[model samples]
Target chain A: MNTKIENKLTPVRIIAFIFVALWLVIAMFPFIWTLWGSFKVQADFFSKADWSNAIFGFHTEKQTGGFFTMDGYYGSWIEEEFWRAVINTSIVVFFTVLISLTFGTLGGYALARSTYRYAFWILMAGLIFRAMPHMTLISGYLQPFFAWNVWGILPTTIIVLVAINQPFTLWMLHSFFLNIPKDLDESAMCDGCNRFQAFRYVIIPIMWPGVITTGLFSFLLAYNDFTVTSMLLSDENETMIPAIASFLGTVQEEGKVMYAVAAVVSATAPLFFFVLFFQRQIVSGLTAGAVKG
Target chain B: MKHSTFLLFSLPSLSVMFLFIAIPIVSVFIQSLHIEHKQVIIVTENCDPFGCETTTAVDTEASAKLKEKAPLGKFNGFKTYSNRMHFAFDEVGEAWKSSDSFTVFTKKLYNYPLYRALSFTLTYTFVVTPFVLFLGFLVAVGVNNLPKMFKGPTIFASLLPMIVTPLVGSLILFWMVDGDGVIGATLQKIFNDNSLSLKASPVLTWIMLMVYGIWHLMPFSFIVFYAGLQTVPQETIEAATIDGASKFQRIRHVVIPHLMPLAIFITLILLMDNFRVFEPIIGFRAEAHATSISWLIWNHLRESAYPLYNAAGATSMVTIFGVAILLLPVLIRTWRDFKEKNKG
Candidate 1:
């Protein structure tokens, strides 16, 4: 594993390396471009007369003489109350990851330990449920929630998101839990620990990697969701993505596209940081299912 | 674990699954059968005072009473499902009956909501899935061949699009494709056309959306395939090379075979995910040019006044049906695998 393959350079290798380098630039350049544009004024960023204005910010007139301006950020965060959306998003992500992980850990442990027909059937049902678009379930939620007068609140939305996230959480954690030696649980039980205690002590310590991975995914699901939140949450409870979307309609109509651009940048910033820190978990979480399947 | 312990462990998730996922499916089916209450209008004519006038007013009291009596309105069975938005049975029949030419008939197909969405959804699913897989494989092989120093950064850069929120990702692309943005402006200058814009035409918009689709999904496939490539037995490659097989021959015969299961797994996931496409259309503001089944459902739910609950339900059911159809092949494959494992 330590020895590097010292193959002679061929034209094919050069071409491949060139393609990889080009793709790397293509993949990473847009975010940098947009993030830069978000710091400039509207006219300069989306200048019709000169494309260089986007980069140079020549049209932006602000006290900061440099090519960047904070006007778009100010307009979005201060005037548009994007902070409220940020708070809402944090609440949703916090609770969604917490609750889904709690429930998923228990269910996935049980499924992983069991050698029964029920576990198989349940996993199968989960596969089917995973395939159902979230919108289909929203109509069902609407009738009962509206009838009960609990439609648009944060708790209702959280509960629904938790429910929606459960199947994947369960599937992921189930496979992860399966990877641990069954003897670990068996010996813990044989030592006078009950099943719950065994899981609490013996399994919990070993399962953190899988749990954290699943939790990260749950957080991303809650954070990046536009469909369920946009549908279920009222105006006051809108998350960042949906709020940014709402801005696209009205703000863009008002010729304030920069507000939406700034908000988009703000919304994506956390994810960029999240990836920088937890890229390992994200990659593992993604490949886990495919490899298992 | 004992039965009681097992029940205690599984109860929370199972209940949530049943309450949210299972029951909602049945409710969606039932809801699609009944129509929402439409306003009863009353018109009257007065021939006195200033002049003869006609007025149209909503019979709110009667409508309210009707709503109270049957909150879900009348049970219309499958009527809503057959309407222009869901199955478009009537429109398809009429379009066939009325069109004098193939072009006219195909143009009329766009007028039917379900077919319009189905056409785009199918095209996007089929086109984007294969391209992503192929491009992902290419990138995976290329990156795998590179020095270890370059791999991490390349992988990191690639994952940004896949990780970003779909709506935000699409909007970033939308901004770039706008008339004034870098890509659009560069494209116009290259073509020497003053009137070129990505948002201006349907075909171009579709291509842009598909391109976004590939971009957004490419990293997932690339990562998965890259991981798969690492597990390819080096001995096989060595053997193929010893036989004087070219690099292409080695990959084609050995590496690809090893990666088949993973590729199929990615394909199944990509199909299911792509079939429910909704966010990009909204983000790109491409609804005027392209619609998906999910968008059709959301459109009904967000409609002014009555909100078309029944129609939305029907559309959701239709979408669910489409997803299930897409999933059938994958399900069969999984079932066969399970059966083979049990036999072994």
Candidate 2:
């Protein structure tokens, strides 16, 4: 904690500081640029005369009689009905997180508590499953889903996402559960409680920290997913990420790229707030697997 | 835990994985062996106009019936795997025989879609992983040197790129680098070439995507390495410094060795992630220049008029094989570690 040695104004320290400053600009600039540009007309945002027009919004002033306009937001949200995609995204993310956590906790608890050889094999299988590219899995599901008449619905996508989420959820929670003392559940069982009861009463009450951390990740996976949600959901049941993508295809010919821009910013706003509120949990969740290994 | 109890506890998770993950892989393998049925054709002769005229037309109803009867189409039995869109065994052989030099042969092979995709995927994975590790370490060390007050805000700023959805993140960058956008305009002005466009060239597009990859992934490695730095033993660092080591020497010897395991962990994760790169290509609209294996399969299913399930299935099977091959060394190492732990 000594400031003199660590914070000395040496040449190396100055260079490192400049590098970090450069990285911060690179990391933060694009989002700030997009968010700013979303308010302007395409002419101003993509301003041919000068890039500074995007900053000052000269064409936006000429067109809309102001420096800022909500035309893009209105076009995307109201005209294109982006709200439906937002609602669909909420439902899918909510249920996917809930169901994945439920199944993950049970399986992870069993894996952590058991001493069988099969436990090792199961974890290994989960590792392999975790590495499977999601698009490849979606390719596998399309034919069967179409044949069964379950291809383009919210529930089917939710269930499929939960299944896809299992391997990661199990690994994370299994490691988390290993950190919890075994005696808590065992001592409860010794007091004449059965296994499920011990889990419900003894383990459940004290498992929130790990569960919350795992749940944040599950929430992120469901929220940020593009492949599964885009391919599996019907056009009518589109989520935000897919809807934003589809907007480009339809709006490009109509000269409405700003609508797509607005939608992209809208979709990212929730995740921005998510990181703001849950930075610690997100950081810990990322390092949990690495640290344990 | 008792076997029965363990089964009871894990039943819901296991059943879903079994029904969804495990079975679909099997189904994908089976579907790869079959291609869509050819359309039924009917030929007729009309004898009214001085000479008989023969006409051929597709029998839609019969083809529909065929599709209805066998939803998986005709069983072509591994033909789909060898077709021009996939592994392209025939094309590879032709290219091998005709080309006089190795480079010429590879250039010919790169024209095939699968090989083209494989080249990009492997290059992106290997190229991005190392940069992520190196730059991420620098950022971690830099952040660690800052006074405690500025650390939280800096970390918050750093997390935004990684935390945002990949497609959206790429799109944000893509727009800025578009011909009329900020960075693109600035570059054109600097280079004095109004015709210059990032999207117009293959090499530039590849670099742009890889740069985006490094930007998006660096934060994850940074956070992990930052955590690793917290546990770097102060005693070792102090001893090295006291033994006439410079600050760089102390970091190079003591700090780097302590963080080596974390670096390996990050590399494994970054490889797995970067190999499956798909969303950024779409977001950047870079498919014209670079296509990944995931994007290739997705294109097969979604871009065509009807889903090319057979082509997609074949690609998926191949991709799964690729993943297995990529993971083989790590799996073997893990297995050895497990065995050693058990023996000990």
Candidate 3:
């Protein structure tokens, strides 16, 4: 490119350039702070932990420690409980996402294809369920777990998560099926293809975006979920957030507080990567429209 | 033929959904009602009979019973309703009523703090939704119309805040806004007196919360609206310009309407998610005057010294109904007014 031509960018372009650049820094500031703070030693944290004093004035004293060390990471490593939380969160996220997606896809396809009366009502039921506050289910439904034995306890937590997530995944994919005009199916039938074949070949390919987006969202729905897990799950298996939370108890148990951040960081690792890897689609895909259900 | 095909397409999905979600919900409802004698609600023993051996084996069969029941009532319709009828926690009457110094509103109000909670969420939803939408739109439109090279980076740049977890987001806000702290001290440079805590004043707390919410949420909205803008038909905008439509008018009439469906989607998500909030309250409640239905439940559960479990359930049931009412307007619009909008 010629130098003069490159320099001849429009005023609008120049203006947007600055705005978005400034925005990216402001946007990344939190994550950057989290990353940096995760590395800092305890005395440094005591200084930075202060909201009023330390932020702009954040500094390291030379005598005490290395500027960039793994005190937080190593400190958190000592807690056996923190590792168990890792297991707990993974269990919930794995089962919750897998189950909801399986049933939700089926449910979405059914609601989309139903020509009968009350089909909309069925879909509406899902929407109302989706709109319900998580606390409602957690509060009313948690009692039943006490009714059962040991096996019922784990499966019960998974059920709460699946119930909470089903409506979201179903409604999301249902819209995708709807936006696909009905003519494709009609034409496929005229071509002598059966209902299953049309959906398998023609409809499914085009709706892949919706499926992927919905699947990713469902994965996120389960992975990012904390409140339901917090309420539903009992001890020893408290999902990641609560595990980290147990560390922050009024007592400075858990050997050190930094591991709480480490545990939080590890728990969110899959979620954070999912967001970053799927950045374009996630950002573009999650609309106010997502609240439709 | 079409019907059969549709049935084939639909049945499998419907069955799984029915099996998992629908059945569980119905089961919960049934469990909530306590008329059935078979439905055992084991009230834990005050004194372990295992420890207090030979303690009052009153009846002949009482030893075989599961820890001895207390006339555990027989199941009947509306039994759950009747059991909790006096515990509705509402003040419904023709006149305002007083319970000691606190004046409970009569004429059927939802739980008092719940009203405050709902209102608090509503105020957040209303302010944050539009503010984020408009800010996102401005950035998106401005960035999209950028030199082709800058658009991609700009879009990626704005998405960082939306991707971080709520815990981290709160921590950042915590670091910046503490009293006589970093952010406060920074403000003190301009406003004087670093001793002022953001938590000290309701106004400051609200302002900071608004800032935190918008900062975190704007990126998500910007990403979606930007895509919606791209799909916006260019010729219509060009024609509007040719007809001498000013920039403001063009956006108000042309761009905004194109983005309405997306806006509604964002609104619905915000309406649902913000109302059911969890993190912000847990983080800010120490100093801030903020508390929602979510945080209230957490506080109760956290202080589980009393195991306020039943009360939490009752509170949750009421909160769900409150949310349903809040969402009812959209429900009415989607069901009844949707076709009207299409025709118009």
Top of the candidates by lDDT: 2
TM-score of each model, in listed order: 0.96, 0.98, 0.78
Whole-model Cα lDDT of every candidate shown, in order: 0.89, 0.92, 0.62
Write one digit per residue (lDDT tens) for candidate 1, span B1-344.
Answer: 67788899999999988998899889888888998777889999989989999999999999999988998788999999887766778778888999999999999888888888889999999999999999999999999888787888988899899999999999998888788888888888889898998888999999999999999999999999999999999998999999999999999999999999999989988998898889999988998899988888888888666577888888888888888898888888778987898788
| B1-344 per-residue lDDT for model 2 (tens digits) | 99999999999999999888999999888988888999999999888859999999999999999999998889999899898998799989999999999999999988989989999999999999999999999999998877677678778998999989999999999999998899998899999999999999999999999999999999999999999999999998888888999988988999999999899889888888998999999999999999999999999998999889899999899899999998999899999998999899
DockQ winner, 1 or 3: 1
True contacts kept of 2: 0.76
- Taking chain A by itself, what TM-score does each prediction score? 0.95, 0.97, 0.79
Candidate 3 Cα errors over 4 Å, as ranges: A1-22, A46-64, A150-154, A179-209, A250-255, A287-293, B1-112, B179-181, B188-194, B286-288, B337-344
lDDT of 3 by residue, A184-221 (tens): 87699789987778777887677767777776776666
Computed on C-alpha atoms, the DockQ of candidate 1 is: 0.74
Better of 1 and 2 by TM-score: 2
Local lDDT at A90 for model 2 = 97
Best by DockQ: 2
Q: Please give the TM-score of chain B in predicted model 2.
A: 0.97
Q: Stretches of candidate 2 above 4 Å error?
A: A1-7, A253-255
Query: On residues A46-114, what C-alpha lDDT tens digit does candidate 1 reach at each position?
Result: 666778888888867443577777777888899999999999999999999999999999999999998
Q: If ranked by lDDT, best first, what sequence of candidates would result?
A: 2, 1, 3
State the lDDT at B228 in candidate 2.
96
